[model samples]
Target: MAEATEKKAKTKKKSANQTLVIVESPAKAKTIEKYLGPGYTVKASMGHLIDLPKSRIAINVEDNFQPEYITVRGKAKLLKELQKDAKKSDTVLLASDNDREGEAIAWHLKNAIQDKTEAKIGRIVFNEITPVAIKEAVKNPGEIIEAKVNAQKARRVLDRLVGYNLSPLLWSKVKNGLSAGRVQSVALRLICEREEEVENFLPEEYWTLDADFVKGKSSFTAQLVTYKGEKPVLKSESDVNNIIEEIKNAECKVVGIKHTDKVVRPKAPFTTSKLQQSAANKLGFTSRKTMQIAQQLYEGVNIGTSRVGLITYMRTDSVRISQTALDEVRDWISKNHPEDLPAEQIQYAVGKGAQDAHEGIRPTYVTYTPDSVKEYLTRDQLRLYTIIWERFVSSQMNNAKTRTTSAEIQAGDAVFRVSASKIVDKGFYRVIHLLSSKEDSTGSLPALKEGEALSATKFYPEQHFTQGPARFTDASIVKTLEEKGIGRPSTYAPIISVLLDRYYVTRVNKQLVPTQLGRMICKILVESFPDVINETFTAEVENDLDSVEQDKLVWNNMIGDFYTPFKNRVDEVMEKQESVKGFLDETTDKICEKCGKPMVKKLGRFGFFLACSGFPECHNTRSIPLAKCPMPECNGEIVARKTKGRGKEFYGCTNYPTCNFISHFKPVDQYCPKCGWFMVEKYDKKNGSYKSCINPDCDYLHSVTEAVEEAQKEALAKENQALKLAEEASKENQD
Candidate 1:
């Protein structure tokens, strides 16, 4: 068979009249719609309309390269719509993002489009949303890059294998309601390990001494540096006190002064980490929350008057600004602050590990100010957009200037250093206020210079102890995850969500603290499955998956290496570990009521309970029942009740649902350890059949609330109100 004959018989060429353009998300539909005209049909895949199946573990582990593919359950309708559109169009244009994931999405779209038409399926990589970029992408339609596609497929299969194989094992061994994930488990392990470190840390006593001095019209503060003309490093309270006594009686005077010219540069536009931290500090948002809002802004937002993208791409970690965006920003700066704009553009070197030429974070459209979009956006959307816009704008401005003055005082051979900064110019700081913050309020040295003398106002001793490392929060975790390359932008939210749902970590006062369950899970992962929880292991797995996208390694080969050890471990645990119970987790605490013997507490299929120390011998076991109402003010005990036929037992309010107190597990008869409020049952219809007392009034609800967007909880309240109104209307009609 000749090659020409085979090509002719395999597929028909596309007609010149029809053109199909496929984008990644529905939210982007309108944004791209405006750019495209009538001859083209534009549709969104709603962000990867196809994905691996959830029900079973699908992997070809024997082969070095195995790729598992599945039709995501709900995307069928979306696929049908896309397929319909693709068939009608002569040419299919894959207009997804330029990243590896976007490339993978385009390939998947092609696989599912099912068009054998002569019009060839093509790929377009648009780095940005401007009209020129779009036009250039259309002109340079490329074939589906197979390496990126394989990388995505590799990641999908790897995650599926870990989840599918590990989740069931968790169900069997741990609490039935619990689940484990790949990236999520790693994140959980990290948080749990951090909590342990914080717990085990020992604080040491230490003290620092400072002195206040006055010269002419200027007052300055300095800290005690050393003793006998040498810096004395004191570690204990007694040592610091001894030094303080020597200095307390001695006369203090400024013996020397030093000055230096300084410039403070504005921070470059936000990378993913900086943006998350800023969002958290300024808006009291979680990293996930920031990302969600940024995604919506990136996709497109209806700013009432006009739909616009408030921010540039949010997934990037690079800090290289494009010359075009820089030029436009410089123009804005010159128009607003002629003094702030540098004589020429200040070109910053690309950050280490940053890719070439991809601009630093900036607003996609700089002209759209947050104030103008306030009425149209929610509080959160506006807050994030404002920060992004301001930061990007400031990045283009000139460096801020500061005048610095330093004075070293001598008090009987013990020296104290004082320093203060005065703003010479607001510079770029006027645009980026967060970067402009300065603590010193006093004016700089008037006529004072080096070798000048001044009188001492007062001296004071301050006592302090070294503090432990702070616990991980969502923002911190996101930073860690990105830095480690353990997960991607999309996985952060789902990872945090899963960790919380599994009770692997809990939030208290906005701090992420590992729960007992979370710690236990971490212990299990660390001790038994060290490879799975290891940061290096996770990053290596991710890298290999990235390689799959590059087509450098076969997906099946990755799974093969993973399965041998995994299966061996599973079998080993299945045989010897008859009960998915660990000695530490399943404790011998519960004293048997029948024999007064210590009974061990182990989690069974239904729930947690204490069985006789000698289970078969004593045969004395009973269900640990729910306790009294957790409400501190209420004086009622709870009883177990199943919803009519749903054999799932739940601890209900003794007040018969009147108090609305319920939980799948027995609520500890105490006030919420946090919030100081009543600990009530939390009933989640999807994924979670258990209950927790994560205080409804707490802000932690913000993170989890996003998880239940597909479910409606307050509907019953509205429904009941509507029902009551209808009943009253019937009475009014009769009257």
Candidate 2:
């Protein structure tokens, strides 16, 4: 009997030693399992196995605004698998990302599985997925932080309150399918206001004069800066012409020469916002694309025989780097190029309101260079990893040095100045120069004395129009949002994406352009809910969320303060606001085919469409015609159509059954100059709008405005030359 009891105890002990690990993604699980070998079973939750229902507002307003949690739809099978694994294991470790969302995910998984198993549960976090880091995290695990979970919950509830309560009001007042968000509405307002400014802007004419001078064999050009000991303001072409006449025969002499040494320090490593901005400007990537690639690098990639995370946490705002990482990078710099190493290790300052929970984005291992692991990563993954490696490596290097020379030349009453810079030392720039968009070299300048004489070779005057405020691009918008504290690192990409998905903004020439529907929705929201969409108010709410994360403020109280007044305002707007259908719709001349009633142009979620005036009696709708059909031997007109699933716009013949002609480009009335084929307006993010011939055989394309302006200029020049010749002939006759 004693021997039987000993055998049973031994079996129980062997079963109790097995452990199960859960993470947010399969890739992350795979990499972590590689570090922690056998006796551990790893599984992925695939992000948020539970959340609030979408059918209704799940918050109990009377009960401290407690959210009603439920197993998320379509996650029952995944939960069953996790529960089965948890029941058999003695311990469970929740290894999610180190952020508010990740914290909430870990908390949810714990609540779901703890009831079914006697396993001890804990949370483990690591900034990077290196083998050493993973093992260290597993050895020292901590419980889930309630403060971080509460912060994430508070944000989700606030957004749900605004979106659920206000979206219905919009549907009744404006149109159906139009939704509003706390942060996206503010972004939409910005785009609409910028569009208004662009429309109302009036260009003013301006001019500048430049002179070319030669001291010996070298030639240099300088702009006119001062005239008659005062700064000249060339407001018109006449002013430029007068300056040109004065400098045409005047002798040029170098009056002032100055030299200065400038140091260009290396920028800090990649914070989430800075990384998105740099990727947008340098790689022409949208914020969404940048974040997507960054996630893949952070999760893990298969490099050779081992799986490894290429970068640290990418969703961080802090510029802090670990001391060990700094030491390792410094040693690398000293070994590879001793001249580029700084005297001491450099430390970067953390920005205002930073959470500082994780290190800045950097390569997990300095030894795994981008080139060494290029074969394992995709093109985008490799490009992003290269930038992360270069940025972090360069951040610890020495500053670059440059020598700048400014030469001021006097030509009669006008003063022309020119400045040039040459690189003296390529320290950090040696790595950054490969990723920079613009060239840094200014070329070498010839030596000149202050009193040296120079002969004026030619004078040129150019006319220019003053430009208005530039439209916001993806990079500029992210920068603006960061500066204003409107959103955090995780929210930037989603905010911009929501605007685009809802048709509130369109990318044209890499600039955000508000559509007509976007303008209408923004006007309605701005006028009715001024406090909700105000930038200052929104930023304060973001701060409140941060306070919740820091345990300074209770999540329920903050939501109450915002919801009480916000709900009242929403009620007032719903009662007082008038329907915009009457103002937005216009009567059309075409009659409906169903009931022979005149059609009216009405705005829908997609765009403008023609609907019957007698809607109840004759329910008919059709797409509005954009232009005449470009196809030969077809009398049908071209109407706007959308792709089946993606809803992308295209133009097609109205008589599609008989004459099947379609064009992705928007059709215009004008014909092409080269082939006499109908022209279409094609748009791209790089180029705003251009006209192209419909005939693919003819390669004719030009900008819409540039072609017209060139023709006008040529006609005006001919008229001016004819008048000059007539005056010369008359002078000859008189002589």
Measured by TM-score, the strongest candidate is 2
Residue 59 in candidate 1, Cα distance off native in Å: 2.1
Q: What is the C-alpha RMSD of each candidate to the true structure, in Å?
A: 16.3, 8.5
Q: Write one digit per residue (lDDT tens) for candidate 1, span 188-257.
A: 8888878888766555555788777777777767788878977777776778778767767676666787
For candidate 1, what is the lDDT?
Answer: 0.70
The true-structure Cα RMSD of candidate 2 reads: 8.5
Error of 1 at 269 (Å): 3.1
For model 2, state the Cα shift of residue 441 in Å: 1.3
Give each model's whole-structure lDDT.
0.70, 0.87
> What TM-score quantifies how close candidate 1 is to the native fold?
0.74
lDDT of 2 by residue, 322-397 (tens): 9989999998889876899999999899999888999999998888887789999998888888888999999999
- Tell me the number of clashing residue pairs for each predicted model: 18, 0
